[model samples]
Target: MTTTPKHDERIATMTFASVYPHYVTKVEKKGRTKAELHQVIRWLTGFDDVRLQELIIENVTFKTFFEQATINPNAHLIKGVICGYRIEDIETPLTKEVRYLDKLVDELAKGRKMEKILRSTS
Candidate 1:
């Protein structure tokens, strides 16, 4: 999809690797584990630890990183406001996915249960 005149092109260009460290810091400062952060990321993107490290080392753009993902089918269940926008209402697919990741990380930092953050497929 063309992230042209309408969508925020900045997020599209920002490397996932650059944002990754901040995510780690956010969770760690809140007394959460890095492993838990990784788990949430894996749930959203379907990237294992090995593949995730490769993407981080490659410094792939958010667009490229998500393009390569097998996003969870239940990701649609992710709801509520994130960064001022309702997750389910976001029109841009890439932006929505990024927000979903953000919401999940926030949940982890807030001590939300893993089962709840991952959501239910049933």
Candidate 2:
């Protein structure tokens, strides 16, 4: 008998609060700005704390990495490191789809196919 693997759909709907316990609570605390919250997420996800701290000090927020992963319905973060990256580095398919949509928008804009301009450049 052959069996196919069952797909899980609940994986993508997870928020930071669900994946990382108390993550939201941590962000709500004082002294942790939005930028710092992103840094903490990065650190938890696999980016080196030292490296993240350096980048955070420079005002660089890498939240997109995490935001990208929560959109997938079958994606989940493992409890180990892979190729020097944490499992949290894995992105959700939903976010990937959103990125594709964004790319499409850019392509459409370059082609001047959009009727109304959503952006203004002077």
Top-scoring candidate (lDDT) = 1
TM-score, per-candidate, Cα-based:
0.92, 0.22
For model 2, residues 1-122, the per-residue Cα lDDT tens digits are: 11112211232333323333243344445333444444433423444556445543544322343443333222232123422323343354443332332332333324432222122222
Off by over 4 Å in 1: 1-7
TM-score computed on alpha carbons, candidate 2: 0.22
Number of clashes recorded per candidate? 0, 5
Candidate lDDT scores, in order, read 0.90, 0.34
Query: Model 1: per-residue lDDT, tens digit, 1-122?
Result: 32343455777888999999999999999999999999999999999999999999999999999999999999999988877778877778998898899999999999998999999555
Worst 10 residues of 2 by lDDT: 1-10
Runs of candidate 2 exceeding 4 Å displacement: 1-44, 63-122
When summed lDDT is taken over every stretch of 10 residues in candidate 1, the lowest stretch is 1-10
